[model samples]
Target: MSIHVVLVHPEIHWNTGNAGRTCLATGATLHLIEPLGFSLDEAQVKRAGLDYWEHVDVRVWPSWEAFEAELPRLGQPYFFSTKATQLFWDAPLAPVEGTVLVFGRETGGLPAELHERYADRFVSLPILSERVRSLNLSTTVAIAVYEVLRQQR
Candidate 1:
């Protein structure tokens, strides 16, 4: 069984790196869609991922279109967005091998076009306090990954 994590237009290297580490820990694959805000080769990214960066199963796609073309073969996709009405736990996230969890950039979340197009596929984490805007990208990824793992267990 495998979990695929897709990060679209990610702007932070540290988040990406941490996400990579999470993916590595969970035996998940990481797919990154361009254009990225920071270089993958940067020291900050390596620092965040530590020496495990090299072991992460990461695939960098040229664009969303490029990645979308391969989506069917990858797995059933569930887009993560704060704007979604459905709670993630309520979603039919299963068959770990067939599940694909897609996340957006740190600053903007997913593109508005994506939100509109995949409205039915979107799922969200609960944010209890009104004072908080959103969780960190890496934190969100970690929680989502573990939730999927928890469900499988």
Candidate 2:
């Protein structure tokens, strides 16, 4: 079983950097969709102050379409969004070979079309407070991936 975390058009380096670390920590693969605001280059990533970038498993995609084309090849792609009706914990995620949890950019989340396109597979972290909108990219990924690990165990 594997958990792949896909970030669409991520704007920050640290979030991606930390996300990479998180993926590495949890035995997950990090897929980054491009048109990125920050650099993913080795030097640029180091500015985020993480020393072990070399060990991080990261893949860069040119666009969401391109990423989506190959996403299915990785496994089932599950969209993560606050707007989704389904909760992450409620979903049945086994440690299967083809399970991916996809996320959107920090400011602009998964586009409406993408969300609507994959509504059945969309999910979110349960927000107890009605006022809470969403979580930070890295934090969200952490929670989702940990939940996946929990399910796997």
Candidate 3:
């Protein structure tokens, strides 16, 4: 099974690193869209990946347009956001080989345009507490990836 975890305009190096680790663990490819806040060579990123960074099948794209152009060939695309009404569990998150999970920046869930463009593709993890805003980027990635894996089995 092939899974693709995409982080668009990701800001935190640590979250990226942790996401990379999760990707490596699950044999999923990691794709990052640029205008990133931190450099990929930073120590914090490597520290979070914990020596597994080198093994990660990571790809970096210059812009969203660049990545969007190749999205068709990647897999079935799913945009994750807290604003979505559809619960992730209710979505057709199966056939792991044909899934590409896209997440937005930590500060902002997803670009307003993406929500408009792929309105039906968006899915959200449930948040019971009103106090909690959203899940951490890395944590969200891990949960989504594992859900895909679970369906595969």
Candidate 4:
């Protein structure tokens, strides 16, 4: 079994590409939920991912609903958000097989309906500065993915 990094309605190709790189490094599968803002063939994405883009275990979904329909009941599903009260470190994450880490778009975070549905699973990375609203989408994914990896080790 492998960990999964899910990006729902991602708007930037570079972020997705960088996330793919992180997934590749961490042995996690990358799932993209459309409609995407940029085409996967875009040069910018390739530039960001370098030569490793093709090596990513990427799966593209038509929509969030479609992705959810086929979601595997791995270890546990954790949603990363800036609005969540629980910190990622505070979550009871273990390095179990098939752990799923879900992230949202760069501009809007996760949909409101998803928040309502998976309220308990929501986790946040601590931001001490009031000047920052949220971290970059790719950065958040990397942090969350490593957290799971660390716990499991």
**Residue 47 of model 2, lDDT score:** 73
CA-lDDT, candidates in order:
0.90, 0.84, 0.90, 0.87
Off by over 4 Å in 2: none
Q: In order, how many clashes per candidate? A: 0, 1, 0, 1
**Cα TM-score of candidate 4:** 0.92
Candidate 2 vs candidate 4: the TM-score winner is 2
Q: What tens digits encode model 1's per-residue C-alpha lDDT throughout 31-145? A: 9999999887758565555688889999999999999999988878999998999999998777645789999999899999999889999999999999988899999999999
Clashing pairs in 1: none
- Kindly report which residue pairs in candidate 2 clash with one another: 1-95
Candidate 3, residues 11-32, lDDT tens digits: the string is: 9988888899899999999999
In terms of TM-score, how similar is model 2 to the real structure?
0.93
**Cα deviation in Å at residue 77, candidate 2?**
1.5
Off by over 4 Å in 1: 42-49
The stretch of ten residues in a row with the least summed lDDT in candidate 3 is 41-50
1-153 per-residue lDDT for model 4 (tens digits): 568999998998878888999999988999999988888875866555557888889999999888887775555788999999999999866645568889999999999999999999999999999999999999988888888888877
Q: Once model 1 is optimally superposed onto the true structure by TM-score, how far is the C-alpha of residue 137 displaced, in angstroms?
A: 0.6
lDDT of 4: 0.87
Residue-by-residue lDDT tens digits, candidate 2, 10-92 = 88888888898898998888888888888767777667787878887888889888877887678777789988898888887
